[model samples]
Target: MRRVLLCLALFFASPLLANSKTLFLNGVYAATYGDIAWDKGDWRGSNFSAIRLKAGIQVVRIDFVSLTLGFQKVGFYSGMHKWSGDNDIGFDYRGPVLELHLFPDAPFGFSFAGATGTGYSYLTSASQYHYSSCEGCKIDAERSALKVGEFTAYVTYKISSQLEILAGAGTRSVKGEIDYDVDRGGVHSWEKGDVDSWKESNTMVLLGLRGSTL
Candidate 1:
């Protein structure tokens, strides 16, 4: 019946951030995906696509604790070769995050938070398999930059009075080191021997929306 009467008018709608903004510009955004429940961290149990662009607007709210400064990103190939879409094992992260929110004025607005961050981790490949043994050169398709750390937990829902409805789940622990020339026909090769020790800890899922103004 119309989704249970819009969940009974937001379950007796009223509190969508009851009162608290003393310098809190919470503007969040979210979209996420996950898999690799556990595969010795070699990820790609299909896809663990995470596109989370968080926001707490570097907050400060003293009543119920809100000290936020947000940002989280986990990436994977979609373009830039590997046949117009890449993935043999891909990873990337862009970070700067900090969060601490409890309560957040509840009313079907269950909020809980804990976040951590450390940036940059990009690796892309499958660039023509290095020309199948250097039959032809001039390929240059190896990209590298590593170092990642992330921790996450969030569940929010306010749905009104300036909107807030988010979904959550997380894991992005892509670690460093891959300094190899690997015959540069395609720039870098895994060959899985030892690229100075590679790593991956993927498992993510997220959904998002955030808006607030005082």
Candidate 2:
């Protein structure tokens, strides 16, 4: 986690950092569990959520549509795929993120975003840290990645020439590896679990404020 944050710090310090108005210190929180539809409408419950953070600078602005480019750190959670009181594997994401915002002069707006180029991290969890040294115990090595994308519609209120606040709700997609899909294999087979991957399309609700160009 520290390494990923350090990478983003360097990314923001590069030439891409400009004086123009942009969004910074942004986050979205959502809980995704239970019998949700995806994976051919299959159910896979393991208590996960789409918790993300990102910061970016405006790259293009035409009328009410603006595009931003910057680094994003995705996922902040203690939830797990196949968890035990002892430990479970965790995931992390860091990559170039792109976002588009559409806002009129009124109090309504919308935004869409996607992120990629992230690698799966097994280092953040204590479970992986302790057991990784043991032979043939590492998980999620083949298809290791956590992917996130979102679409949100919001109502905004301008706070100043350089700031605005928004409240919104929509859906976001998150993909990650599963040690054992609780819905498919059930918890009984957690002992001899098989590897699997899943993509979740879940609800999103957020309150955020951003700095817009002056």
Go through the candidates in order and give the C-alpha RMSD of each one to the true structure: 14.1, 11.7
TM-score of each: 0.30, 0.50
Best by lDDT: 2
Residues 1-214, model 1: lDDT tens digits: 3533443344223224233333335533221111111111234233534334444443465675555564544442331122223455454454566665555556344344444444433334544232344434433333345666655566665666555665656565655554323545546553322234456678655665555321
Model-by-model lDDT, in order?
0.44, 0.45
Where does model 1 exceed 4 Å of error? 1-59, 62-65, 70-86, 92-94, 98-103, 110-124, 128-141, 146-180, 184-214
Which digits, one per residue and each the tens of the lDDT, describe model 2 over residues 111-201?
A: 6666564546342232322122223343332223566565555555676544557666666566765432122222222222243565667
| Error at 42, model 1, angstroms | 19
